[model samples]
Target: MILIADSGSSKTDWRGIDKDGNVSQFRGVGFNPYYQTPEEMATELNDEFLLKLKEEVVAIYYYGAGCSTPENKKGVATALGNLFGNAKIKIEHDLLAAARATCGHEEGIACILGTGSNSCDYNGDKITDSRPSPGFILGDEGGGTSIGKKFLQDFIHDEMPAVLKEEAADRFQLTAQVIQDNVYRKPFPGRYMASFCRFITEHTSNPYCYLLYYNAFQDFFKKHVTRYSNYDQKKVSFVGSVAFYNSDILRKAAADMQIHVHLILESPIAGLTLYHKDNL
Candidate 1:
């Protein structure tokens, strides 16, 4: 059996491929190496996913956030090996997952847009290179967290029209106290960041959202992928809910920038799982 995992700051997608080549997918909580060490992360996995394990397990490939550093990658692999016992495990950064999904048989740009954001240059089967994934600090331009930050700023600073503001407040059930607690007293700040995605998507077709996508895509392209001018003319794809589900405007924005878009996946976990099954 081969196991593949695509984990982010919000949720982990676990797919198990049996020896018969049957495929099954499972879900677990978020495990970010920036915050959760492998020991801690494996504990969460054990509690949520230990039941899925069997004696016939063979190879495990994990593509996760914050595993870019060699030290972190080795540490995470060790911790997971401890959990999986003698299972052969390979740990890699999430960008590889994005690359394999977006450029399964061709070279292009691939971005993961979930709780955080990252972009990479894929040469068909592997990530030949990637932009600096700056977490949520100066980057994550098109991610759910960024959208949520925009929505909160609009609501908190009275940027929205009076009627829309009232509607949004009523719709999301947000209060000053709730915002304070969620922002400051929360366990996962990224989840709080994700809280604003639905609200922003509610107004996605508006001028505000139109500009938001345009600006964010431009920034992501300029700050990240453009350094590789050789690939500038190729298509760029998006993976995750914000960019995939809201692809109408995102596609237009890319087109406006003369960028061809090849795919928009609600969750690239499907592609990642299939890649592992077929290739690994």
Candidate 2:
């Protein structure tokens, strides 16, 4: 059996395929070497369902966030090795997952717009260029977290329209103290902030909400997409919940920038499943 995983900081989607070509799918908690230890990851994977298939897994392809550095890659590799002792494990950064899932051996620009955002210039099989992703705190333009950050700032400073402000207050009962606690005292603050994206999507008809997403995606294009050589000539594709749910706004932003959007997937798992199946 082959195990393919597309993981973000928030969740992981897993697909298992047996020699007979039958497939199974499951979900698991997200893993990031930056936050969890190898032992912790192993423990998380020790569930009955995962353990039952351990011996059947011949190969494991894990593409995830925080797997960019060698140390981080080793961390996840070690954890997987502990569980699937006989299986070959290949670990890679999530940006490659987006590229593979969206571009599928075609040259294009792939972008991830999830809890965090990233982009890479993919030349068929490998990433040829990429911009620095300073994570969610410093930068992550067009990501849910970034959008939520802007929403919070506007809400707190009374910059949002009065009706939307009242609605936000009524819906979330947010306060400055609550914001500080979530961002500073809680775990996975990026995910916490991204949770508000649902509210933003619900209010897209409002001019304020429309402009918020428009400006955010525009910033993403300027800061990341424009840096690539002749980026306008390449087809742009996206993967992640932010891009999937707000495709209308994303397409508008792309059109405004005169860039063509080729694809937008809520998650890359399905495309990844096909990629792995065909390659195997």
Candidate 3:
């Protein structure tokens, strides 16, 4: 038995697997080390939930944001180890989760397009190469949160140039307080940004809304993801709700670069759970 977790800044996706296949799923609070201390992260795992598992897991595979540093990974793995007494635990960055889930034993580019966006080149055994993926602030291009931030900025500054603001206000309930709280608070911003993403999905083909994708993806490719241009694998893939649900824009971006894309899986933890079940 194995436990696989793909955690982000906003949510932690959990899966339990046996020799045959995935058997159970449990949802827990988000577990990014940059957002919380080790003790705080450990507290999110409850004893009742631990005891309720159908089987005793032999290993735990945790891939999450902010675990890129060795110290961070050590701290997180130690905390989870204390919680899951008998199971061996392995921790890797969330990009590795996307890499393993998308490319697996093959070679290719793997991307995560959720609240944040990232890309890396994977060559079977490990992540062979990558460029700096600046989160939300300087980068994180082609992500829900990035697009949301742009929408809020433009809408607030009255840059829409027409009556669309009225529809946005009616649909989003985008109050001034909502704006302030989202920016000032710590974790609240991620959720607030996601709401804007929902707004985009609701109006997928709107001409006014279409520019955001071009801006985000173009920067992503030009600044960070261009490393894949020299990669051995011509196929690129994606994993995460944002990319899976809205793949056409990503496909379009790839087409401009002449890259052939193979898959757009909604969730990577599903594949990770199976990978751990077999390899661990």
Candidate 4:
């Protein structure tokens, strides 16, 4: 049996394959060394179904956020090691997962736009170049957090249409105090901000909302995608809810910048499952 995990800042999608090629799926809270301790990760993974399959597990492949550095990767490995004591474990950055899932064995530009964002040039098997994604606070231009941040700013400053502002306030019951507390004092503020994206998506027909998404995606391409040499010659693909859900705006943004989009996926877990199953 083998276990493959695709994790982001908000949740993890786990797929297990048995000897007969049968598959089972499970979900767990997300883990990031930057935010959660090894013990906390273990507790999150202590699900009854996961424990039942532990002894049968021969190997574990974990791709996650904040696993770029060796130290951070090892942190997640340690947590997995404690849980699946006899299983061989491999840990890698989530960008690699996006690359493998989107481009497969083909070279291309792969991007992640979820609660946070990142981009890399994949040379079929490994990442050869990348633009730094300073997370939600400083970057993540095309991600959910960034979009939500823009919406909040417009709403709070009364720059948005009066009707839309009233609707948002009524729908979310948002206030300056509530927004500040969640963004400043809460854990995983990126995820909290991203929660507002649903409202933006719901109101995308509004001109203000439409331009907001377009500008954010345009900024993403300008700042990140265009940084790679020969980027125009390679296929570009995206993986994450932001990319999948807002594909119309994303494609428009790409088109405005003369970029060709190859694919967009809501999550990489499905493609990752196929990749691992074929390799096995």
Candidate 5:
């Protein structure tokens, strides 16, 4: 059996393919080697995932956030290796998962716009170039965290339009202290911020909400996508809830920048399952 995982900042999607080519799946809270310790990740995985299949897994292909550096990759690999001692495991950065899922065997620009954001230039088989992802605090321009943080800032500062402001305030029961505590005093603050995107999506018909998404995606194109060589000429694809849910505004932003937007998927797990299935 082979297991493929697409782990983001908020959650992980796991798909297991048996010898007969049958597929089964489950979910778990996300893990990032940059944040969680190896022990913690192992504990969480052991607690959440089905234990019955532990020995059945012959291999694990894990693509995850914060696994870019060698140190990070080793940490994640060690944790998974310990869990499924019989399996051969390969740990890789989530960007490659996005690239494989979106571009497949074709050269293109692949972008991730989930709890956080990243982009890379893929030449059909490998990532030829990529911008440094400084995480949610410093970068993640087009991601859910960035947009939600911006919205919360406006909400806190009384900068949002009155109608939207009132609705958000009432709907979320948000206050300055609550927002601050979630962002500053909590763990996985990026995921907390990204959660607000659901509300934003529900209200996208509102001009203020629409512009918020537009401006965020605009920043993404300027900072990440536009920097790639001949970027506008290449096929651009996106994988993440932010890009998938707000594809209209994302496309509008891309149009303004003369970019051609191609595929958009909520998660790379489905595509990844197929990729590995074919190879296996």
Candidate 6:
């Protein structure tokens, strides 16, 4: 059996492929080497369904957020190794996952736009270049969290369209204090902020809501994609909820920038499953 995982900031998606080529899936909390220790990850995995298949898992391919640096990569490897003792483990950055999933051995630009955002220049097998991902605070320009943050800012300052503002307040019971508490005083604040995208998505017909996504995606192109060498020439693909749910706006933004979008996936797991299945 082979185990594959694509982990983001919000969740981890698991796919198990058996000798017969049958596939099974499971979901669990997201893991990041930056936030949790190897021991913690091992312990948590033991509680998940993966523990039962540990012995049978001959190879484990884990692509995860926060596994960028060698140290961080080692941390994830250590955690998986402890559980899947008999398996060959390979740990890599989530950017590579997006690349392998979307580009499928073809050279292109890969982007992630979930709770946080990141992008890379991929030459098919490996990432050739990438911009620094400053997480959701200073960066993540076109991600769900960034868009939500902008919406919330406008909401707090009475800058949003009045109808949408009233509906948002009534729907979320949001107060300035409540917003601050979630963003400043809680864990996974970015996830909390990103949740507001649902409301934004529901109101896409409203020009204000549409522009929010449009402008954010525009910012993403200007800040990240435009920096890649000959970016307009490359086929760009996206993996993540923000890109998936807001694809129309994403494409509109891309078209304005003259970028050719190749694919948009809500999660990379499906593409990853196909990529690893060939090797397995």
Backbone clash count for every predicted candidate, in the order shown: 0, 0, 0, 0, 0, 0
Candidate 6 — which residues are off by over 4 angstroms? none
Best by TM-score: 5
Q: Report clash pairs, candidate 4.
A: none
Predictions in order: lDDT: 0.77, 0.91, 0.76, 0.90, 0.92, 0.91
Candidate 4: Cα lDDT at 191: 86
Off by over 4 Å in 5: none
Per-residue CA lDDT of candidate 2, range 1-280, in tens?
9999888888888899998878998888888788788898888888776788999999999999889999999999999999999999999999999999899989999999988899999999899999988888889999988999999888888998999988888878888788889989998888888888899999999999988888999999999998998899999999998899999999999998999899999988988889889878
For residues 22-58, write the lDDT of model 4, one tens digit per residue: 9999988778787788888888889888899989999
lDDT of 3 by residue, 1-280 (tens): 7778888877788887776774788777677676577888877776465556624877888899778889889879877876787888889899899888878898888888888888888888798777776667766778777888888888888886356678888876876666877787656475567567776776667866766776676666676566666643467788776777677887887778766778898878877876776764
lDDT value, residue 48 of candidate 4: 88
Ranking by TM-score: 5, 4, 2, 6, 1, 3
What candidate 2 gets wrong by more than 4 Å, as runs, is none
Off by over 4 Å in 4: none
TM for every model, in the order presented, reads 0.91, 0.95, 0.90, 0.97, 0.97, 0.94
Predicted candidate 1, C-alpha RMSD: 2.1
Q: After superposition, how far is residue 188 of candidate 1 from its true place, in Å?
A: 1.4
lDDT of 5 by residue, 153-174 (tens): 9999998889888887798888
Worst 10 residues of 4 by lDDT: 27-36
Per-residue lDDT tens digits for candidate 6, residues 193-223, read 9999999999999999999999999999888
Better of 1 and 2 by TM-score: 2
Superior candidate under TM-score, 5 versus 6: 5
